[model samples]
Target: MNFFKTTYTSKLVFTALVIFSSSCSDDYLEEMTYGEISPSEMTSPGNVDRAIIAAYSLLNGQYDASSSAFNSPASNWSFGDVVSDDAYKGGGGTGDQNNIHLMEIFNTNPTIIDIERKWVALYEGVKRTNEAMRLLQNSQEYDVALKENRMGELYFLRGHYYFELKKIYNTIPYIDETAATVNDYAVSHTQYTSEQLWDKIEENFSNAYERLPNDQEEVGRPNKMTAKAYLAKTYIFQGQWQNALDAANEVINSNKYSLLPNFRDVFLPENDNSSEIIFAVQHSVLDGAPDNYNGSIGDRLSAPGGPFYSQYGFHRPSQNLVNAYKTNAIGMPVLDNKNLAEADFVDPRLDHTVGRPGIPYLDLGVLYEASWARDLSTYGPFAPKKRIVSANSPYQIKTWPYISALNYYIIRYADLLLWKAEALVELGDLEGARAVVNQVRGRAKDSQYVMNLEGTTPAASYRIETYNTPWTDQATAREAVRTERRLELALEGHRFFDLVRWGVAAETINAYLEVEKTRRTHLTNANFIEGTHNYFPVPQKYLDYLASTK
Candidate 1:
C-alpha cells in the first residue's frame, strides 16, 4: 500500500545523464557516470522496487523537471478536453495560458509550451519504465514470479506512456532497453509506420496481459484484467474490431468490475480505488512532499472559484456538452445541435459531471453562480464538477492552489464498457452493443440524482433511460454509441482522442466551432483542418534535437 511513498531521485538523475550523454563527445561520455548505481549494485530487490515505484510516479505527469503543472497534466485535460468540444480553456482571459488558448482554437504549432512539456512528461514516463525494466532484468536476488509480475507492471506503464505519445504526436521514436547509445535513442520518428507503432504499443500490453496476476495486492498496480482492458482500448484505436471485441469480452466475462450505484460517487476521493476503476493515477495529499505536489497537481487550475474553493478556475465545460445531456420525452438523448433551454429535461449525469448556474455544487451548501466561473464571457457559464473533490471533504488540501487526493481514472469500467459497445457496433453486433450501452445507462438511471440547494428535490428535470427499442441500423447504432461516449465521459480527457480515432475530429470540431463561435466570441476564427490538425505537430525541440544529431 505504501508503494507510491518512495522517491526515485537517483533514477531521474541517471535518466538525465543518458539524455545528456547522447549529445556529448565519445571521450566526454566515457568519462561520465551514466547512473547512480552500477549494474552489480542494482541487483538488490529493494533497488528494483524503488525503480518500479519511480516509473509509477510519472503517472501524474508532474515533476520538478516540468516547466508548468497544467502544461503536462496527467489527465490530458488540455490536449484532450480543451482542444475538443467538451471544454474551453477557462482561465484569467484569452491571453492567460495563451499556448493552451492556441490549442483550444486549433491554432497549435510545434513551438507551443504545452506540446513540448506534454511530450517531455510522457517520454520521461517512458524513460522511467525503461530504467526500471533494465534494473529488473539485471537483478538476480528478486523472487522469480515477483520479478516477472514487476516486469509486467513496467510493460503496462511503458505501453501507457507510448500510447499517449502515439495518440498525441502520431509519429515518435521508439526506444527500449537495447538502446544504449545516442544513435539508438535518436531513432527517427518515421522509422516505423503508424500501424507499426500501434503494434509496438500492443506488444507491451500483451506482455502485461500474459505476465500480470489476476489480482494485485497493491491498490495502484495494474492486474490482468487491467491489461486486458487496455489491450481492448488499444485494439479499438487500431480499428481491429475483432481483436478489441475478444479482449473486451475476456474482461467483461470476468465480472470483476461493475458500475458504482451512484454516478457522482465514482469521482469522490473515498472511491478513488473503487471497483469501477480499471486503472487510475493514484494521488496523495500531505505525503511528505514540500507542497501537495503528489496530489492532483496537474488539475490544480481546474478548481472553480467560489466561497469554498480555490480561485484559479480552468477547464470549464462547454455549453455544447451541457446541451448534449438534454433528454427527450422518452428519456433518451435529443441527438441534435440545439441549445439547452431551462425547461429541457436532461440526463441526471449532467448535474454530476458539470456545474451549471443555480445547481448546488456538490453539497457545498451554496448554489453555483456565474461568479464561480473565472471567465464567463470567454468560456461560457459552466464549471467542471466530476473531478473536483467536495470542498468539505478531508481529501481537499487547505492550501493556496487547493489540490485534492482525488485519483484521476485513466480507464474506468464504464469507459471499458463503452469501448466494448463501440467494438460490438463495429463488428455488426447491434443488439450486443445496445445491451452494453444500456448496462451503462441503467446505472445512470438508477443512481442518485443531484438535488437542489435544500436537498429536497431533483436539481433539474433529470430524466435518462436506456434504449428500450432494438438497434437495427449500423450507422445509427454507431452514432448512438459514440454519443453515449461523449455524454458518459464528458470532460474526462478522452474527447479529442476519441474524435480523432473515430476520424471525425475535423467534421465534429469544425461543426462545433461553427455554432460555438457564435456563443463564445473567442472561437470566431477557429478552424480544424483535416490532415494538419489530426495530430499536434512534433515538438520543435524534439525536431531540433533530431537535427542536431544529424
Candidate 2:
C-alpha cells in the first residue's frame, strides 16, 4: 500500500540534524556529532535524494499538532465542501469544532486557530521544497539530469502549496527560496493582487513543465503532463482563455492519460495510480513506521458516525448536493427544484459520491441508515462516501481505523477535460466545448451505476445522458460546464473554489441557505457576504509575526 515504495532511511537523521543546527549558538558553533549529518554533509547524492523524499512527505499535511480535526487537513472537506452548498459540518453538534461551525455559517474571523494551522502547515510544505532545492544546488554527486529532475519536483511542489494558499486566502504573502529567516514573512499580503498571485503560480508550473520528464520512475512523482494540467488550471483560474486552451490542448495531444472506465474505481485504493489521476497526495499504511500518519488523515474525522464505523461524522452531504444529481426526463440535469423522489432519472455519481438510507454502502454489506448520522437534527441523513475507507479494503490501517491509504487526487484527467471545456466556452467555441463536456458525460453514462444487495437491480433510477442538442450560446455552455464540475468533483473539495472563480459564491450560497434553512433549521442564520466572506481573512498571527520584525 505504500505509494512511495521506499522509505527515506536518512530522513530522521537529517531532521534531527536540522533541528540541532537551528538551536545552536552562533558564537559557539556546533560540529557534526555522532550519527548526525550537517548541511555540508547533504552534498552526497543519497542524502539529497532523501531530502527530496522528505519534501514529498510534506504533501500529506500530517503531523500537525495545532488541532486534531482541522489543522492542515489534506481532504479540505470542511473548508471547500461545507463552505459551499455541497456538504454540512456534521459532528456531535455545532459546539464540536466550533470554529468550523462558524466557518460553515460565515461567522469565523481572522484570529481562528484552524486557518492559522492550515497556513502554517502549507508554508511548512513550501519550506521543505525550498530546502530540497537548496540542497540540490549544493549537492556534488548528482548529474545534470538528476539535478533538473529534482528542481522540477521542487517547483511543482511549491506551486501546489501556493495554489492551496491562493484558493484559501485570495491575498497572501509570497515567499521563496530567498527567505533565509523568519523575518521574510514581514512582507505584506497586499503587496500583490490575486491576479498577480495567480501569475506567480503560473510561473512555477511553467518552469516545472519545462524541466520535468514526460514520465517518472515513481508512480506519485509528477511528470511533464502533470505540470501542464496545473498550468492549464491556473490559466483557467486567471481567465486567460487562449492560454488555458493551449495548455489543455498540449495535455490532450500528449495522450499520456485518460478517464478510467468506471468512476468509482478512480477513488479505490486498489486503483491508486490509475490513468485518471494527474497528481495526488500518495498515502500508505503499515510501511514499518511508528505511526500511520501518512494515511489519509483529513478523512479520519469523516468516517461514518455509528457503532459500525465509530468515527467522527464530519462533512455530511447536503440535500442540495443530492438534488443536484437529479436528472430530467431526457436525462439532463434538472435545473429546477423538483421533488428528488419524483425525478425519473439520476446521475450514477450520486450513489458513488453519497451514502443515503437503504443503499448498500460500498461493499460493507450493510444498508445505510438514518442512524448512521451523528446529528439528524442538524446534518442530514446522507454521509460522504467518496473519500471514506471501505471496511473491506486491505489498505485500511486498523491501528487508525478511520484512515485510508487511498491516494487523494489533487488533479485528475476529468478535471482537465472540464477546464478545456470551460476555455472553449469562453473562446466562443461552443461546439468544441460540447465535445469536451460530452466526453465526460459519455464516460459517466458508460460507467457503473449503483447496485442492490441482490446485485440484479439498480440502486436508484440511474440514467445520465450527454447533451443531445448542439451549438448552445456561451451563457448556457458556461452554466453546463459549471454544473458538471459541481457533480463530477462534488465531495472531493472543489465546490467553493469553483463558485468563487465563477464570481457566484455569495449569490449561490445565500440562495442555498434560504432554501436549506427550511429543512435543516441549524442553517437558519447562515449568510454569505459578497466581498468579505469570499475569501478567509489572512490570519491575525501571520500579521503579528510580520509586525514583530519591525
Maximum-lDDT candidate:
1
Residue 528 lDDT in candidate 2: 95
TM-score of each: 0.95, 0.93
Clashes of 1: 0
lDDT string, candidate 2, 1-550, tens digits: 3448346222422332221122222311122222567767777888778778877876766533222434567778877998999999999889988888899999979877668767766776777677778778877788978799779988999999999999898888887777655455457889998778988998999899999999898788999999999999888888899999999999989998899989888989988888888899887776664356667766777888655576588889999998999997678998665447833588999989998888889988778888898988778788989877787788886555467788788999999999999999999999999999999999989998889988899988898889979966789989999999998999988999889988999999999898888888778778999998988888776676566556
Per-candidate local distance difference test: 0.85, 0.80
Single out the weakest 10-residue window by summed lDDT for candidate 2. 19-28
Task: Give the per-residue lDDT of model 1 (tens digit) for 385-479.
Answer: 99999889988987755899898899999999999999999988999999999999999999999888777899899998999999999999999
Among the numbered candidates, top TM-score falls to: 1
Question: Residue 260's C-alpha lDDT in candidate 1?
Answer: 93
How many clashes in each structure?
0, 0
